[model samples]
Target: MSESKQDIMRFPPSKITDVAKALSGDLRVRILEALGDTQLSVTQLAEALGVAQPTVSINIQILEQAGLVVTAQGSNREKLCSVSCRSILLELPSRPGDGLHKTEEIRMPIGMYSLCSVQPPCGMANRDGLIIGSTDDPRAFYMPERTDAALLWFSGAGYVEYRFPNPMPPGVSIDELRLRAELCSEAPSFRMDYPSDITVFVNDLPIGTWTSPGDFGDRKGKLTPDRWTSGTEYGVLTEWSVRADGSYVNGARAAATTLERLSLKYNQPIRLRFEIREDADNRRGINLFGSAFGDHPQDIVLSFIRFKEHQEGKES
Candidate 1:
């Protein structure tokens, strides 16, 4: 099955038994194995399973009833059945009615970064569409009023770092650490062909790199101010997660980085950095959009799930 980040089917504790029952039958499991990640019509499934069409259809109905499969009409009007999702995550709450098993999250504003070592073409602007300080000056990032900045940009090999306050309870361990931001490559104005390798560091450890496809500006951004008619308009919402096994960017394995190397064992602040090295193959620069300047109405966000020993044992 596809392990795409957004391709998970999460079920509540109440529905776990129902889904389990759907997979109890050997014929249904075989049907799913035949389908894999592809969709197949009843006739096609029957042929693949070497079973009668009527039998295949009956099993398909049972799987659909348990929300294990989805049926849709094909181009030729033939019925198509597919395993609903690439993977399934069942949240077994420590106690009943835990409400989707909430996780700790922090929506850090873009301008709240603690430090920045940047170069020319660096600048910041407020929500009113006014520059915070002089453009192409790294000193502008240190201005006191930068907290109100709605947009920021910088070029060359440097980074903007944030020291997030650690609020984890003593003795608790984290299962995953995630960060999401709306960003894109920077150019003179905006270029559709520019690309840049942006790397993310957590606890001062290199975790992953997401190569921005390009500086997106074909059309005006939905949240961009009307007066700001030129230059880069928007960015893509990218997510990076560090897990026990390795690091992942938008569901794809990005690197061999894992939580153990992050030095997150202690309850200390997390220093996160987005850096573009001087030797990068694509050094187009970086553009970070705030809540008021990007297509997405958000800045930088950090989130994670903590696993207590008892809860972990119960879940396992």
Candidate 2:
């Protein structure tokens, strides 16, 4: 399946009623079928479906609210609508009357790190290729405007740390934690052979290191802003998960530091750090990509799954 199709929108039983309502209409179903093949404007969809433009517009609004389709204004100022997902899965409760299995997710902007220590050959840019300050200046990382950056790169060794709120309730315990980011090796221009060992740490405990294959700039990133050029174009979207058993990077075992070893506390926030160590076998440096500069339209994502008090005690 394509990446867009793989992106599933899951709804709980409570929201199933709304989804059912949205699908009950025959016109809406036809609209979705038409959009599945190609993006169309309101006028085009109306003509293709042999319906009036106003009627199509109304149905499109309903689909948009149901999260079935996404509509945006085109350069010509016409509304363009497209299907957002290829499939919808209704997620039932794990057990009858068990209530909802709550999960929390947080998206940290690429340049919103609270702490950073970088070396030369480092710089930051926004979506429009607007440089924040002098290149290789460590102080630029501290500027207030850094939060607006869509891309950041560094040579040699450095680390950026972000603090995320621990949303686990007082009695609840985290069952699993996952961190996701777009990353790649850093080079003066673009080098497919460049490699970098990028490490991730949670609460100062090293979870694992992922070896970036190369710095990719052969073509424009699918979502990279048009103004961005002469810089790194894209990167691999990497995900790392930590559980009680062990830690895994992209589904492969990378470290033995499990959730228990991290000793997470409910009152304290979680600290996450991404680094390229000087002594690493591959010191090609690192490039961090944000939604505006990468093929994937996402920033650093942190997800937490919590278990009930009883289950937590049993596992502990």
Which candidate number would show the highest TM-score if scored against the true structure?
2
TM-score of 1: 0.66
lDDT tens digits, residues 1-316, model 1? Answer: 3553238788876566667888899999999898887879999999988999999999999899878898999999988988887678886744532332335677888899998888888888887778898988788899898999888888767889988865554445578898999999888888988889999988778788899988888988899887785588899999999999999999999988898788774457899999998888888789999999979998888886755432533454
| Candidate 1 lowest-lDDT run of ten | 93-102
Q: Which stretches of candidate 2 lie over 4 Å from their true place?
A: 1-101, 306-316
Please identify model 1 stretches exceeding 4 Å from their true place: 1-101, 306-316
TM-scores, all candidates, are 0.66, 0.70
lDDT (tens digit, per residue) of candidate 2 on 216-292? 99889887878877668999999999999999999999999999998887788899999998789998788998888
lDDT of 2 at 128: 78
